[model samples]
Target chain A: MLELKNITKKYGNRTIINDLTANIKDNEIMCIVGPSGAGKTTLLRCISGLEKIDGGQFILDGKQFDPTTSENNVVGVVFQDFQLFPNLTVMQNITLAPELVLKQDKQTAQRKAQELINQLNLDGKESLYPYQLSGGQKQRVAIVRALAMNPKIICYDEPTSALDPNLRDEVARIIIDLKKTKVTQIVITHDMDFAKKVADNMLQVQPIK
Target chain B: MLNYIFEILPSLLSGVTTTLQIFFLTLIFSIPLGIIAGVGLISKFKPLKAVLEFYVWIMRGSPLLLQLIFVFYGLPMMPGIQIVFPRFDAALFAFILNYTAYFAEIFRGGLQSIPNGQYESARVLRLSYWQTFRKIIVPQVVKIVIPSIGNEVINLVKDSSLVYVIGIGDLLRAGNVASARDVTLLPLVLVAIIYLALTAILTFILRRVEKHFSYWK
Candidate 1:
C-alpha cells in the first residue's frame, strides 16, 4: 500500500494541495476526479515526485520512502499530451529508460519493449514516430514507455484529453487490464463518468484559495 | 570576359579557399559554444546566468564590425591586458564570439518553445538531467532552431567579407585588390557570383534537412 499523510504542496504564497491524506492500495486502479483548478494534476505530480511535497510523508510497506523530484525516482508519469519524444520512434521511446537508467542491455531492453508493444497491440507500430500515431496509439505507447521503467506506481495526467470522446471505452479497458500487472495505477481525469466506470476508488481534489 | 575570368580565377580561388576555411571553422566551433551558452542563460545559478546574460548582451548590442576592430586593434592597447593575437586568430575570435551569441539566442528561443510537460515527464520517468537533455530536449530544440540557425549560417557566409576590414586576404579582399590593380569591376563581379553560388548550395542542403524533420511535427 502507498500512504500519503497530510501531504501539502505550495507555490510560493499560495497552496495548491493542502494537507491531503490518502491511501492507495497495491494492484488497483485509483482515479482522481476534480474540476479545473482543483489541484488534481498537482496531487498526481506530488505522488509521482514530479512536484515536491511541502509537508507530509510517503510510507510504503511500513518504511519511510523519500522520493524527491529528481533523478531515478521510481515513479512514472504519462502526461496529458502524451509528451513522447517525437524525434524517437515508439520502440526507442519505450526502450530508452530501461537501457539508460536500469542499465539493461540493448537486447534485454528490446525484448522487453517488444513484449510490451505486442501486449499493448503496438507491434508493427514500433517503428513509427509519436506524431505518426493516433491519439489512442500514442497513449498506449506512452503507457508502454512508462511500464518499461518498472515503476512502483504509474500516474496518468488527463490520459483521455488527446483522445477522441468515443475512445473512453478503450481507455477504461486499458485501465482494467493494467490491474493484472500488479503495479498501482493512479489516473487524474475530469471525466467523472469515465472515472466511475474504471475507478476501484475515486479521489476528488479541491484547491485551497 | 572569359580571359579576364581566367586571369583572376587562381587568386580568386585561393580567396575562396580561405573563405571556406573560415566559414567551416567558425560554424564548427560557434554552434556547440552557442548551445552551451544558450542553455546556460537560463541556469538557476545567478552569477553564471548573469555573466552569460551580460556577455550575450554585449555581443548582440554591438556591431560585429566593431567587435572585429576591438579584438584586432583595441585589446592589445588596454593597460592591464596587452596580449596580442595574430591577425587571423583575432578575426576568428571575434566572429566566433559574435555568432555564438546570435546562435545562443536562437537556441534559447528553441528552449522556450518546449512545453513544461516535457520536463515533468522526464523527471517522473527517472532519467537524469543530462540524459533528458541529450535524448529528449536537444533534438527538439535543434528542430525548432534549424531554420533560424540556417539563416545565421547564410549571414556568416556574406559576413565573412568583413574580414577584409582587418586585411585578412579573404575572397572580398582579393577581389578588391584585383579590382583596383586591373582598373575593372570584373573581379568583384566574379566574387559576387561565387558567393551567390555558395549560398545557393547551402539553401538546397538546408531545404533537404527541413524536409527530413517534417516527419516530426
Candidate 2:
C-alpha cells in the first residue's frame, strides 16, 4: 500500500496542497479529480518525488520513504506534456533508463522495450522519434517509458489534456487496462467522467485558496 | 589590371592561408571551451560559477585588440610577470578568450531555452545526471544554438582582420602592404572581395545545416 499523511506543499507564500492525506491499496487505481488550481498536479508531483512535500510522510508497504533521500524511481511520472525526449527514438527512450539506471544488459533491455512497444501497439514505430508520433502514439510511448522502470506506482498528470475529446476515451481504456498488471496508479485529472470511469477509488482535491 | 593583380596575388594568398590557420585553431579550441564554460556557469557550484562569471566579464568588457596587446606586451612589462607571447600566439590567445565568452553566452541562452519539463522528464525516467545531459539535453541544445553559433562563425571570419592590428600579417595586412607598395587602391578592393567570398561560403553552408535540422520543424 502507498499512503500519504498530512502532506503539505507550498510555492513561496501560497499553499498548493494543504495537509492532504490519501492512500492506495496494492493494485488499486486511484484517481484524483478536482477543478483547475485545486492542487491535483501538485499532489501528483509530491507523490512522484518530483516535488518535495514541505511537511509529510510517504509510507510505502509499511516502510517510511523519504522523497529527498530515497532513489526517486519508486514512483514514476508521465507528465502532462508527455515530456518525451525529442532526440531519442521510441525504442531508445524506453531502453535508456533500464540500461543506465538498472544496469540491465543491452540485450535484455532491448527485448523488454521491444515487447512494450509491441504491447502498446507501437511495433513499427520503434525507430520513430517523438516528433513523428501522433498524439495517441506519443501518449502510449510516454506510458511505456514510465513502465520501463517497473515502478511500483505510476502517476499520470493531466493525461487527457493533450488529447482530442474523441481520443480521451482511449486514455481511460488504457488506464483501466493498466490495472490488470497489478501496478498501483494515481491519475490526476479535472475530467470527472474520466476519474469515475477508471478509478477504483476517487478523491476530489479542494482548492486551497 | 591583370599584371597588377598577379603582383599582389601571392602575398594575399599567403596571408589568406595564415588567416585560415588562426580561424581553424581558434574554432577548435574555443567551441569546446565555451561549452564547458557555459555548463559551469549554470552549475550549482557557487565558487566555480562566480569565477567563470568574472572571467566572462573581463573578456567581454574589453576590446580584443587591447587584450592582444596586454598578452604580447603588457604582461612582459609587469615586474613579477615575466611572460611575453609571440605576436601571432598573443593574438590567437586573445581571440580565443574573447570569442569563447561570446560563445559561452550563446550556449547559455540555448541551454536555458530548453523547457524545465525536459529535465523533469529525464529525472523521472531514472536517467543518471550524465546520461540525461548527453542523450537528452546536448542534442537539443546543438539544434537550438546552431543558427546563433553560425552567426558568430561568420563574424569570426571578419574579426580575424583584427589580428592585423598586432602585426600578424593576416589577409587585410597583406592588402594594406600591397596597396602601399603599388600606390593604388586595387589591392584593398581585392581584400574586400576576398572577405565577401568567405562570408558567402559560410552563409551557404549554414543554410544547408539549417535545412538539415528542419526535420524536427
Candidate 3:
C-alpha cells in the first residue's frame, strides 16, 4: 500500500500538483486519467520518487519514502520513452537491474529475463535494441524489464501514447494481463477506454494551474 | 626509405618504452579525472560547477606547449614554490592536465545527451546515485564520448613529442638528436612516419571499439 499525503509540487510561481493526496492499495490497478497538463504525469512521478514534492509526504508500504532521505527502491517504472539501453540488447536491459542490484548470478538473471521475454511474447527479439523494435515491442520490453526486478509495484507514464491505435490496444491488453498478477499498478494515461478496461480504481487528476 | 628505416629502427625502438609509458600513464590518469571533472560540471552546486569550469577553461584555453613549459621550466623559477613537481614528473603532469580538460568536455557532452528519464527510471529501480551512475550513466557516456576521446588519444600520440620542449627525449626529440648529428632530414621524416603509423593503428583500434558498442543495435 502507498499513501501520498498533501503532495504539492510547484515550478517557480506556478503550482503543478497542489494539495493532492491519494492512497494506493496493494494489488490494485489504478489508472490516473486527466487532460493535458493535469498533473497526472507529475503525480505519478512523485509516487515513483522521480520528482520532489515541494510540501508533502510519501509513505510506501507504511515506510516514509523521501527522495531526500534516499528513496527506497521498492518500486519499478516503465517510462513512456521506454528508456531502454540503446547500446544493449533486450535481454541485457531486462537482466541488468537484477544482476547488478540484487547480485543475482548471471545465469539466474538470464533465466528470469528469458521467462519474462517469453511471457511478454518477445521470444525472438532478445537480441534487438529499442531502435529496431516497433513502439509496442519497445513498450513490452520496458514492462518486462520492470517485471524482471520483481518489484511490488510498477508505474507507467503514458506508455502507449506514442504507439498507433492498434499497438495501443495491444499494450493495453498487456497492462490488463498484468493486473491478474495483483501487483500495484499506476498508469498515467489519457485513454479513458483503456483505463476503464484495465484499472480497478480510476483516479482523475485535475491540473492545479 | 627502407634502408633509412632499417638504419634508425634501433633508436626508434629505444624511444618506444618512454612513449608507451607516457601514453598509458596519461590515459590511466586523464580518463578518470576527465569523468570526475565532467560530473563536476553538471553538479547542482554552483561553486563546484564554477571551479570545475574554470579548471577546464584554463587548461583548455592555454596552449599545451605553454602549460608544459610552465609546469616543467617556469614553475621551478618561483621563490617559495621552488619545487612544485619534479622535472621528469612535470612532463606527465602537463600532458595529463591538458588531456583531462579536453576529455572532460567530451564526457560532459555525452552525459548531457542522455535523457533525464534514464536517471528517473534508475531511481525507481531503487538504484543508489553511485549505482545508477556506474551501471547506467557511465557506460552510456563512454559509448557517446568514445569518438571524441579516440581523437584526443590520436592527438596525444603526437603531443608526446611536446615532452621534448621540456628536455624529455621522445621520438621527435630522438629524431632531432639524430638529425643534428647526421646532417640529414631522414630521421625527422622517420619521426613523421612513426607518428603516422601510430595514429593509423590507433584509429583502427578506436573504430573496432565503436563497432563493438554499436553491435547490439
Candidate 4:
C-alpha cells in the first residue's frame, strides 16, 4: 500500500499542499484531478520522491519514502512532457533503466523491453529515435519504459496532454490496461473524461484558500 | 604546384603523426572536463559556480597565444608554486585548460537548451542524478553541442600548430623549417593543405555521430 499522511508542501509564501493525505491500495488506479496550479502535479512529485514535502509522511510498502534511509523504495513516474531520451532508439529507451539502475544484464533487459514493445504495438519502430516518433507514440513508449522497471507504483502527470483527442483515447485505453496488472498508479490530469475512463478511485486537489 | 607537393609529401606525412596525437589527446581529455565544468557553472552552489564562471571568463577573454606563454614560461617563475614537467607538458596543460573552458560553455548552452521536463521525467523513472545524466542528458547534449563542438575542433587542429612557440616542432613549425631551407614558400602552402585536411576529417566524424542521435529524423 502507498500512503501520504499530513503531507505539506510550499514553494515560498504560498502553500501548495497543506496537510494533504491519501491512501492507494494494490491493484488500484487513483486519479488526482483539479484545475491548473491545484498542486495535483506537486502531490504526484512528492509521492515519487521527486519533490520534497515541507512536512509529513510518505509511506510505500511499510517503509517511508526517505532518500536518506531507504535501500530500495522504487516509484516509477511518467511526465506529461514524455521525457524520451532523444539519442536512444525506442528499444533502448525501454531497456536502459533496467540495465543501469536495476543492474539487469543487457540481454535480459533487451528481451524484456522487446516483449513490452510488441505488447504496445511498437515492434516495427524499435530502432527509431524519440524525435522521429509522433506525440502519441512517444507517450506509449514512455509508459512502457516505466513498466519495464517493474516498480511497485507508477505515477503520471498529464500523460496524454500532448496528444490529439483521437490519440488521447488510445493512450487512455493503455492506462486502463495497465490497471489490470495489479500495480498501484496515481495519474494527475485535467482530462475529466480521461479520469472517468481509467480511474477506479478519484482524489480532488483544491487550491489553497 | 603538383611537383612541389610530390617533393615535400614525405616529410609532411611524417609530421601528420604528431598532429594526429595532439588532436586525439585534446579531444579525449577536454570533452569530459568540459562537461564537468559545464555542470559546475550551472550548479546551485553559489561559491563554486562563481569560481567556475570567473575561470571561464578569464580563459575566454584572453588570447590563446598569451595563455600559452603564461603556462609555459610565466607561471613557473612565481616564487612558491611551480608546475614541474617538461616544456611540452607545460604546453599540453595550457592547450587542455584553454580548450576545456571554451568547450564547457558549449556544453553549458547545450544543457540549458533542453527543457526542464526532460529531467523531471528522468526523476520520475527513479533514475539517480548520475544515471540520468549519462543515459538521458549526455546523449541529447552531445547532439545539441555537435555543431559548436565541430567548430571548436576545427579551430583546435589549427591551434595545435601554436605549439611551435614552445618548440614542439608540430606541423607548422616543421613547415617553417622546410621553408627556411628550401626558400620556396612551398611548405607554407603545404601547411594550409594539411590543416584543411585535418578539419575535413574531423567534420566527417562529427557528422556520423550526429546521425546516430538523429532521433527526430
lDDT of each: 0.89, 0.88, 0.84, 0.83
Cα deviation of B166 in candidate 3 (Å)? 2.6
Arranged by TM-score with the best first, the candidates are 1, 2, 3, 4
TM-score of 3: 0.88
Per-residue lDDT tens digits of candidate 2, residues B96-213? 9998998998888889988999898888776777988898899899999999999999999989998888788899999999999879999999999999999999999999998887
Deviating ranges (above 4 Å) for candidate 4: A60-74, A106-111, B1-25, B73-87, B164-170, B173-185, B212-217
DockQ of each: 0.72, 0.68, 0.58, 0.50
User: Per-residue alpha-carbon lDDT of model 1 for A1-209, expressed as tens digits?
Assistant: 88989998888988888888889889888999989998998888777776778999998767767777334546788888888888899999988888888899999999999998988899899888888888999999999999999877889999888889999899889878988888899999999999999899998886566
Q: Which candidate model has the greater lDDT, 2 or 4? A: 2
Docking class of 1: medium
lDDT of 2 by residue, A47-132 (tens): 77678889988999999997545674788888888988888888888898998889999999999888878877899998888889
Per-residue error for B54 in candidate 2, Å, reads 3.7
DockQ of 1: 0.72
The candidate with the higher TM-score, 2 or 3, is: 2
Candidate 3, fnat value?
0.70
Candidate 3 whole-model C-alpha lDDT, 0 to 1? 0.84
Residue A192 CA displacement from its true place in model 3, Å: 2.7
Question: Which TM-score values does chain B get in all models?
Answer: 0.97, 0.97, 0.93, 0.90
